[model samples]
Structures are given as C-alpha cells and as structure tokens.
Target: MTDSENIKEIKKLGEEIMIGGVRFKSNVLMAPLAGYTCFPFRLMAERLGAGSAYTEMVSADALKYNDKATTKLLYTDAREKLKCVQLLGAVPTVFERAVKSDLIQKFDVIDINMGCPVPNVIKSGEGCSLMDDIPRASKIIESCKRSGKVVSVKCRIGMNPQRIVIEEFARMCESSGADMITVHGRTRNMMYDGEPLYEYIALAKRSVSIPVFANGGIDSKEKAEEMMEKTGADGVMLARYGFENPLAFSLLTGREINDTKLSLILEQIDIAEELFDELYVLTYIKKLASYFMKKQPGTKRYKLDLYKCGKVSELRELCTAIFGSDDNAGLV
Candidate 1:
C-alpha cells in the first residue's frame, strides 16, 4: 500500500463518534479492570490513543451512601477528558441516585456493570447474575437513563453454558433507552478462562441499533483486527492486555509497535508522579516494570530490582540502565 493508503487504513481503524454528544475519538476502548484503570492509568491510556477510558467499577450503593473509598474511585485527572464511570449494583434506587449525583454528572458517560463475574457482585443480583432477570435489569437501565447522562450497559453472554441470552438482553437494553451496549463474549460461568464466543457478540450487535462494543480476550493487534472483522462490532474494549501494554490501542490501529513502549512507561510514570507522591510513583513504576518485563529480555531480573527499589531515584536509575534512554518511550 502507498503511504496515503496506509494513513487512510489507520484512520479507518481508529475512527471515533459521539454517543449522546460525548466525543470518543477512537473505537478502541480501555476496559475498566478492578484494581487498574485509575485516573493516572486512564490518562496514560488516552494519551496513548485509546478512544475512551472508564474508571474501574464503582459501587452504586457506596456512591449513594458517600463511601469515601468508593467516591475516590470516581476521581479523575484533567487530562482524562473522555471519561466514563462504571457503576455496579442491582438496586434501582441506589443506581438511580448514583447516576443522578453531581459527581456522576462530571463524567462524559456512565456505564452500568452487568458483566463482572466476581462472587460479591453476582451474589447481590448485580453484574452477570442480572442476566437471569431481564425485567430487573431493564428497570435499572431505565433508572440510569433518567439521570440524563449517556447510559451504557456492559454484560457477559449469559449465566452459564446452557444460557446465552445476550441477544435478548441487548435488545432489552435498547428498548430501555440505553445509549449503547458492550457485550463481553464469555458467559458468566466462563469468566476469563475460555475463548470468547464471537458468534454471541455478533448476535448482540445485530440485536441492537445503538453501537455495540465487543469485549473479552482481545490481547493483541491481530486478535483485535480479527474480532472486529468477525463480529462486525462497532468497537472492542480491552482489559488485562491493556494493563500489560497501554499502547495496545495504537497497535490495534495498525501503528508499528516499536519504541512506543518505553515512551508510554515514562508517560505513565510522569502522570503517577504528578498525581501522587514519590512513594506512589515508586509503586506504579514497579507495577509497570513488571508489565514491560513480560515482553523484554531479562525482564524478570528488572522486575525483581524494581520491586526491591524503595526510592523513585533508584527506580529511575534502574530504568535508565535497562532502557538506555527515554527518547523512544511514548506510543507509536
């Protein structure tokens, strides 16, 4: 392909749109992982070209009752311009109040958490457990829509192997006034272990008129491209793979995954330093070092040293020694 053709292909692959007037510049999104996807991490992902980023799932009940820790998860940096907050709860009133709260209004989008398969979430009749009760789930979506923010629902295919109800549930979400829907192709019972069922996601996509984003097991650019082609999804939301490589967005858009790795690590470190103190920076660096070590040679040794380093200066020295220079550390 010619240079112009390559640029066009990249643009096509990284296209964006406005859902309920909220701007999303790319189709690839960073999924909200429980302990990850904090403000600093979201900002780093956005900077690396994720079209959108969501806060890890917050409790609707906790937000309504003013739980300080839960509220903290809702916090965002100024650079997280395309922010979406994900809320998990089965109670209609709590979910309603949480979405209507002034804090939630600060976000560009509000995502309902119906895909999480954790026991705590499922036991409460929230998350994936809601799939068995479409009426209750529909009511929750209706309540969220009343909050006046763009409402989106993220859900798995079903509760177990015998129940793949994504198409029906997705249709219900649309009928309930949800602005968009995200379908993680694994059933609740499958969790993260098995291959995602793309056929189920395709069914959901066909059932909804609003944009449908496919999620689950998208770890590499090749897999991303294949999923989009196979399911005909409007976008793909990435989870664990994003934590391991923030620049997976650029890679999915057909960018050359060369030196961009180091740049993103430094960028994340800078963001962490600005958001918290040196101690937080040290912690983030160690976490990030482990992630990067997965791909680079002798990374296990670097990760061990990173974990042992107590000071930011020590971590910086270790990074310099390993990466040589910081010139090529950003996203491609």
Candidate 2:
C-alpha cells in the first residue's frame, strides 16, 4: 500500500461512528481480557485512544445470583467513555436476567462471549462450545437483545478445524438480533495457535450487514491495516496484544496520546488502590508491571522484585525506579 493509502486507512480507523445507536470517538476497541480489563485498565485504554473497551466476561448465573466478586468486576465511573460488558453463559433465561440486572443495565453495549476457548468454559457448554449448538446460541443473543442494549457477539470461525463456520455463525448472530459481531479468526481446536485465517474472517464480514470486528494476531498498525484489508472488517478487536500494550489503540491509530507505559502503570495503581484492598492492589500491579516491562532489558529481575513487594508502596517505588527514571519506556 502507498503511504497515502495507509494514512487514509488509519484515519478511517479512528473516525467516529454510530454503532447500535451509540456514538464512539473511534473504531479501534480494547477487547476484553480475563484477569485484566478491570475498570482502571478499561479507563486507561479509553483515555489512551480506544473508542470503547469491554469488561472481562461476567458469568450470567453469577450476575443473576448477585455474586459479589462478579459485581465488583463491573465497576466503572464517569471517567470511562463507553461502558460494555461481555457476558459468558449458555442458558438463554439466565442471560435474559443478567442483562436486565441492575449491575449490567448501565452499560452501553453487551458483547456475548461465544469465542472464549478456555477448557472450563467449553466444558460447561458455554463459549466456543455454543457454536456446536446454533439454536441455543441464537436464543441467548435474542434474550440479551430484549434488554434494549446494543448486543454483540465474539466468536471463533468454527468449533472443529476441519470445517469453518464464519459465514453461517455471523448470519445467525445478526439475525438473532446482534447489532454487531466479532469473528476471532481461529477454531476451538486451534486455540490461539497458527495464523488467523484471513479469508474466513472475510467471509463473515460479507455474510453480515452489521459491523464485523476481526480479532486475533493484530498487534500493530500494519497488522490492523492488513486485517481490515484482507477481511474487509469494519474494525479490529485487540485482545492479547491490547493488554500487553494498553496504548495499542493510540499506537494503531496514530493518535497522539502522551502516555508512557510507566505513566499508565502508575495511573492504574492509583485507580486500583481506591477500589481494592492493599494486597489486591499490590498483586495485580505486579502482574500488570510484567506486561508493561515485557521483553525489556532486566525485565526478569523487575518481575521478581515486583512479586516480592508486600506493600503497595513498595510496588509503586519499584515502578518509579524502573520506568520513571528511564523516561522514554514505550510511549504512545
């Protein structure tokens, strides 16, 4: 692609749009990542450049029962630009209640997790296994749509690698009242391995009029552009790569966000401290610090030291020493 063409595509990515009656500031979004995507992380992604960000998948039954831990995961505030929750479950009735529940009703969008490849989730007949049962998955989507929120689905191309179901599954999501669909370009058996089949994602986009967001293996502007060009997808959902570099939205769209991973890490620590106990804050930041410092020189030592931090102050001190002094440690 020419330089001008690349620029145009990047411009298109960050452009504002109306998806499911909700106005977003950009098209690039932070796909939900388990153990991450907490309120602080989502807020950071949005501030950095993501048009929207999703909460880690909340279990429908847990929501219905008002599980405290699950409810806490739904935390958000005015700082967030858009609120979205990804629900994981198999029972349509449970999904119906979860969407209507007070905890979930505040969000602008509800993305159903039909693509998660975790073994436990699959065994429960939820996530990717739902693809094997079309009628049930359709009912779950319909149920969530009734709540009046813009409902979306994230799913793999197929359950078995032998046969890809991108087109058929996407149509099912749309016809079942999903306002949008995200096709993770991999099968259940493949998990997160191999190259994402660009052609299958293209088939899904062609099959549905609703906006299609392609997920998997997109970590940079070039890959994002390639995914859009190959699949004709409306947007790209940055999952693993997104959390690894929360500034992905800014980087991918060429947005001028004045944030270094260090600064963002400190900011996350502050937000997490307010909502969580000291122990929780310390442990979470330690894990997050590893992601920020990934592949950097002396990263192994930093990870080891972070885990040893018994106090949040110690973790903060370690971060400042490691990244604050470095100045230009991964900026966006």
Candidate 3:
C-alpha cells in the first residue's frame, strides 16, 4: 500500500477500538502528565486533534476520603469529548470505591495508573511498585471492572531492570478484565532517561488481546510512525512531549506545522483565560510560552521579561511585542 493508504489504515484502526462506546478520532492519545495535563492543557490537546486525553493520576485514597484539594484534580469541563480519568492507588477497596463514585462516571473511561514512578507513589505500593505484586494488581483490576466501567491500565515494563515482567503482568490484567492497556517501555529504575524499549512494548502487545498503546519517547511525527512500525501498538501516547508542543497531535496526523498552529496556540490561551481566572490563565500561558519559545529566534529577551511579569496584561504586552499584536495577522 502507498504511505497515505498505510496512514489511513492505522488511523482507522485507532478509531474502532472504543473504550466505552466513545470513538477516538485518531490513535494518537495525549498521555497524562502530572502538573501539565490539567483541564486547560487537555483542552488544548483535544483541539489540536488528539483522539483522546487522560487526566493526571488522581489518588484513589484522596478521592474516597473527599480530600478537597485532591478531588479538584478530577474536575473537568462538561463539554470535553472522550474524557478519561486516571486513578492511582494500590488499595483495591479505595480504588474500587473511587471508580464507582458518581463523580467519576461523568467521564468516558476510567484508567488505572500503574506507571508512575514518583517516590511518594512507589513507596505506597502504588504506581510501578504494583508490578512487584501481580496478585494484588489483578485484584484491583477485577474490582474496578466490577464497577461496570470500561477499565484500562497504564504501566511500565517492570519495577527495575532485574524485574522484567510486563508480558506476565499484561496477561493478568486482561484475564482480570481490563479492556485496554498502555505500556511505557521502561523499567521504573530507568525513569524517563533512556529511549523507550520498543521490543518490550511489542512483547506486551503480543501477549494481550486487548488494545495496547505504546507510550514514551515519542516527540515527533516521524518518531510516532516509527514506534507504530516497530511495536505494532494500537496507539501512541504523548506525555511531556505534548506539553512542549500542543500541536503535536495534528503534526503527527499529517497536518503541517505552520502559522496556523501558532495562531491556534494564541486562541487556546485566550480560551484558557476565559475558562479560568486571570491569575491561573497567566500562569498557564507563561508555562506554555516557555515551551513555545524554546527554539524561536529572538525569544530569549521576551521570555526573561515574561518571567518577571506579575499580571496578565504584562504577559499580553510581552506576547504582542514578540509574536505581533494584530489578532488578524498570524503570529510570525
């Protein structure tokens, strides 16, 4: 088949594997990144054309106990399409309760996070630590499935290099009734350091009948295509890379990156300002601006000025000086 035909086939395959009867537009999913995949960021990714987007890992213990601060992380706009909430915790009962809560059912899918390697998470037998105890993980999966929600699990290959057990664990997740799985091709010990292990992800895909998405090390469209070719995963998930490039989904799906993307970013910032308070919007735009300015010429000075700004007006002025002020003329 021609390259265009091949791309069409892959994109179609992604749309057919529904999590809970909601169709994804593409197989390229924006992976949830803590502190970055907040509502505003997810909205940006969705507008950029990602098939689906996940929330950062919300603690089951916090949700079940009604911890206000933690519960806030689960908040989302009512209009978001293909919204999925990812819960993290090793306690089966707490996780089950959290998933069954009326609050969580508002989403299209419920994802169990087993891939986080943060010290606090792993120390509690959650995240990557769950890989060490396959039985407990299986029980959690079973309990979650009993909630009648479409269940998905995101996990790494192993707790460490010496404990490679993804293939075994993936089978247990499927047998325990998980509808889908996302494999980040690295041991917990590797953190986000090395290139993702495509072979390990491929192994997980081979062992499971359910759709397996490959996550990690995908930062560009060429790399995304290479990952699909190598691992045969049903989808690709972007984490930090998406934060650094909000237009990544469109770029990978064959859309060229031009002034149009830059314009979209500006419009997204405007929406973010309207959706959230001015203070929150400024902070979000400041964070995104740093990423956008990374390689742009003559942005260093503007970035420095932006870092010192205390209000939204200051940010807007800085953006105007750097990217041009006319709303109709695309940012250069």
Model 2 lDDT tens row, 1-332: 43223322322567676789898778788898888888988998888788889999988888857776887899877888789999999999999988888898889899999988889999999999888889999999999999999998999999877767777888899899999888899999989888998878888877878888888998678888888887777888898788878777887767897878778888999999999989778877887787777756666766678777899888888998888756437842
Q: Per-prediction TM-score, please?
A: 0.89, 0.94, 0.88
Q: Write the per-residue lDDT of candidate 1 for residues 1-332, one digit (tens) a residue.
A: 32222221222457776777777888888898887777888887786678888999988887766675676678775667787999999988888888878778888788999988989888889899999999999999999989888989999999998988988999999999999888999989888988998878877877777888889998788788777776778888888888887777777755444545555666667777776678657866787667765665554656667778988767777876666645325432
| Residue ranges of candidate 3 with Cα displaced over 4 Å | 1-16, 65-68, 255-262, 325-332
The model with the greatest lDDT is 2
Q: Using lDDT as the measure, name the better of candidate 1 and candidate 2.
A: 2
Give residue 166's error in model 3 in angstroms: 0.6
What are the Cα lDDT values of the candidates? 0.79, 0.84, 0.78
Error of 2 at 269 (Å): 0.9
- Residue pairs clashing in model 3 are none
Best-performing candidate as measured by TM-score: 2
Question: Which residue segments of model 2 deviate by more than 4 Å?
Answer: 1-11
What is candidate 1's CA lDDT for residue 197? 88
Q: What tens-digit string does per-residue lDDT give for candidate 3 at 1-332?
A: 43233332243323435654557777788887776677777776776778778898888777767665565567677668777888889989988788778668777778898988889888899998999999999999988888887888999999887899999999999999999899999999999989998888888887877888989988777788778877778888888777777667676665444544346556767777776777767777888777766656666777678888888777776766666634322322
